[model samples]
Target: MAIWQHGGMPSSKNTQFAVAVHVLTYLAGQVERGPVSSDELSASTNVNPVHVRRVLGPLREAGLVCSRPGVHGGWELATPAEEITLARVWRLLQGADPVLGLHGPNPDCPVGRGVQRSLAAIDGAVAEAVAAELERSTVQDILAREVQGACSVPGQA
Candidate 1:
């Protein structure tokens, strides 16, 4: 389950950030294989096709990916895989949402108000740390790791 789904003050969005990364990494690997339909992407990510399409919208707008139409229609990377950093994807998808979901506690309760303020103060730092760590790697980095046997696929040994 995703953090957003937990009841700390749930977000309206689902796991778009993870889906975007998966879609981009998959596209990078399949670049020479031609466009991949949303069905294919969804199958690989084990996510709904509608959700995959929704995730693609922002990436398409940001020029990270492009799509085709008709019989062979689907998505491909618009930019080089190395140019698409995880930080970039995170910013495009998860930037606006807090690193930790925040709760709207009762204003009249002193303890609630104090806790909310304390948590809010640290949120920015936490978000920055996440982005910084993400910036150290790109989509190509992940692909290369997989190719070099440095990482394992979920279902394969």
Candidate 2:
């Protein structure tokens, strides 16, 4: 198997970002319905509930989600889904870093120095493109489509 296929290129950080997006999109649909338990989300994602809560901690601080405590308590979106764009989600999860951080080039070669600079520029452009694409999507958009698909079958909840 290729190194990337074996978990080479996309780091844990990227995975966490993706998970956060999925969780947020899921919660957006449940906003009007009611709070969703982390266990339920974990079951849907096939991940541990602890991991889900760990990731959700940041979103909560960002004011994207609100949690309650009680027998029926769980989490709900803090804001309207349409008002929360994917760009906002990415920013909340990834912070202000470039999507790709730079690594120091070989100090022994002039070419390496130049390549590092060029790569940094490319990374900046890629980050901008990513942000632009994310900005075009909202949690509402993803949830509306996905929830409908999941609920399409009769007797399926």
Identify the leading candidate in terms of TM-score.
Answer: 1
lDDT of 2 by residue, 58-148 (tens): 8899898898879989889898888888887787767656567565555667997899789879987887899899999888888877735
Runs in model 2 deviating more than 4 A are: 1-13, 96-102, 147-157
RMSD of each: 6.4, 5.8
The per-residue C-alpha lDDT of model 1 at residue 135 equals: 97
User: How many clashing pairs per prediction, in order?
Assistant: 0, 0
RMSD of 1: 6.4
Q: Global lDDT of each model? A: 0.83, 0.76
Clashing pairs in 2: none
Clash pairs for candidate 1: none
Model 1 CA deviation exceeding 4 Å by range: 1-8, 148-157
Worst lDDT run of 10 residues, candidate 1, spans 148-157
Q: What lDDT is reached at residue 28 by model 1? A: 90
C-alpha root-mean-square deviation, candidate 2: 5.8
